[model samples]
Target: MLDWDDLRIFLAVARAESLSRAGRALKLDAATVGRRIARLEEEMSAKLFVKSPQGYALSEAGDRLLPHAEAAEQAFAGAQEELSGAAGQLTGQLRIGAPDGCANYLLPQVCARISDANPGLEVQIVALPRVFNLSKREADMAITVSRPTAGRLTVQKLTDYHLHLAAHREYLANSAPLTCKADLRGHRMIGYIPDMIFDKELDYFAETEAQVVGLASNSASVQTRMVQSGAGVGIVHDFAIPFAPGVVRVLADEVSLKRAFWLIRHADDRRSERLTRFAEALGQGLRDEVTRLERLAADTTLAGL
Candidate 1:
């Protein structure tokens, strides 16, 4: 019989696309991952990957086997969750994936409410730049700026908010008046590193024609910190810096950037009270934060937060 663990290794290698990377992700050594793959291939009489300088690419048979393997994996997991759920006391780990800065401020409050509601629930929160796959159950829940793509998931729009250029007090006083986008030429801009999709909604200064990016990072927290430290002016969402201690929103009335936040959860577990509780708690937090964020944007007094 082909081992289930062997199939799991094959799935991981295929998903990650590199033996070494899959090894690190699976917490297995390179030799072990290679050995498992070799053993599986020998048993099945096939080659699974074509290796090259660019890394491993799946062979034809490997490609065909992927969906089946993933489907089986999902079936097994759903069965487990459903069976455990039927027994009634809420149990099992619930993974929440969210971006750093917002998750740092928001998820804890929601989680505390969930944990209170279900004592047996174990919460694991991973702060990532985005959600990867809802179909595969990469995380049980996600807080994201994007709508969930999986049809089987329940998606709730949490809030609508906008982003504006923010600068240190020194930059506003010493720098050119940010009355219009054209005023941005030559001004150093702190921004998300190129390749961040979230930056697409925040191209506030790109049309200014004089745009200059002084520094970049993929993290919202990093961008907020740099802007607060006087490194450069950066585009930040109202929620992104609702409590920024030293920065001020620049040209809030002029920037045309706004977006909605969403909470995504798989529907297979939708009827579970804990899932519903967690989602409701999170939605309430987001609703409350949206009001606070708008008030922050309106409060021109000191960026005191």
Candidate 2:
């Protein structure tokens, strides 16, 4: 009925038979021990100890629970050992969640390496959307561009990414080039729904006619493919633009915006090797890969935007 911590405190009190002695043994104060024991007793609905002039003595309920207490102690100890082995050996599934773009372009190789390294460990990469649950354990680790604020969640800034309005090179052949951010208003735009919103920054292109709700699907990959196919000028990240025959950069007049990417894990769940190794390996590898790709994207801009 009680938590492991409460059970540990209760066992200490029952073994010592003195609140003060149990508190001393557990490195907690007598009041703390009393409260924990009270909570346990309330949960089990059994008076565990009776107060005497000397100190605490086991009640009938407490006396009867001694064997079960010892068994629980041994069982918990065994569980701890098994968890340690699981973490160290990583003989389980590693679930990594991220947005579609990162999950598609980056995580595949990283997951392959993780699976190859830990043959016993299986890796499932889930591309969670803008609003997903990490606290509910939807996935073990996340590759995100937005900052998250969840209890027991730990985040690390993995890398920086830049977005630009781009289009097919052929599409831009006869049209006027977008010299400034506002020039995008005149272009036939292929837009993408905002994935990781830069809500805090005054990103120039966030909510203009450039990103007019009048346009296409919400998929980033769709935005990329459409732009590549000369469907319309779209806002695509530098890293996702494929070096196809036709793509070109549209509005190069002003710097759009660069966002910080994050690799996050639940602090409580980091004890597992599946999460630990995957986060570390995937984060560092993706950062390195993105850095290299960003440099390449700078060299060959997207077609139109």
Candidate 3:
């Protein structure tokens, strides 16, 4: 029979694609991790991973073993939940991957509230510009701008948020008068690097005439800072506007964009009561927070007028 402990180590290495990384995650030394993997391979008489300069790539046998191992892992998690009784509090670490914009502006307060309610829970937010690979266990769950069309995943639409062309008050004051979209061409534009835009929804300027980006970054937080510094105008999330003082909507009526955040998870994880409870709390928290922030943004804009 395959040892569950060895299988656990194998899963870690497979997900991390490196013995050192797996060891760090499992709190085992790299040599020990390698020995365990070698032992598992010998017992099965199949090479599970191929070491390359890039890292460990799973061999065909490893790929074939993945689903079974994941299923066993889930089964163990379910067993633990059952044995622990109804604790009414989630424990262990839950990592969520999200785009930098949402990560910076929304998750802080939202996660704080969640953590406050569940003292046993540890929440981690992995902010990156690219899509997270749930299949590789990159994160426990992910927040995305668009629903994924392919994957063994389940998605829930969290909330619809607004974005608009915005600039610092000083920038607008010093620059030439802007009366219409046509005038945007004369102003310095701040936005994402065209090639670095990972999602179609993030291509905010593609449909607009502001083709030239004088200040560009892949991070929304960076772009927001650039705009807040009176560098240039850019499309900024309404929920984020209140956080950027002196930043106001430039052409709210003429230029507006709406996008939604989606919560995605491995389809099989729905069976876990712990994750279900956390997901419920996270969804509600995010929805409420977005609404509150957007209202604050609108009020801030109106008050400044």
> For model 1, which pairs clash?
185-210, 243-305
Q: Over all chains combined, what TM-score does candidate 1 have?
A: 0.67
Pitting candidate 2 against candidate 3, the one with the higher lDDT is: 3
Q: lDDT, candidate 2, residue 189?
A: 75
lDDT of 1 at 2: 68
Q: Write one digit per residue (lDDT tens) for candidate 1, span 32-82.
A: 999999999999899988888887778998877776676566565556656
Best by lDDT: 3
Error of 1 at 79 (Å): 3.3
Q: Against the true structure, what is each candidate's TM-score?
A: 0.67, 0.64, 0.93
> What digit string (tens of lDDT, one per residue) describes model 2 on residues 1-305?
55778777877777677888889978999998998888888999999889889777779998787556655654664465467655444455557777777777667876786677667677888874464455444666777767877666788888887777777877676676666666666677765444544234313355444635335655566667888877667767777765444665555445456777788876655455445655777778877878876777777653333
Question: Candidate 3 lDDT, tens digit per residue, 23-114?
Answer: 99999999999999999999999999999999999999999999889888877876775666547777677999999999999999999999
Q: Rank the candidates by lDDT, best first.
A: 3, 1, 2
In model 2, which runs have C-alpha deviations exceeding 4 angstroms? 1-90, 194-204, 207-214, 243-245, 302-305
Reference-based lDDT, each prediction: 0.72, 0.68, 0.88
Off by over 4 Å in 1: 83-159, 169-189, 192-199, 207-210, 214-218, 261-288, 301-305
Best-matching candidate per TM-score: 3
Supply every candidate's count of residue pairs whose N, Cα or C atoms clash at under 3 angstroms. 2, 9, 0
**In candidate 1, where is summed lDDT lowest over 10 consecutive residues?**
296-305
Look at candidate 1 and tell me the lDDT of residue 74.
55
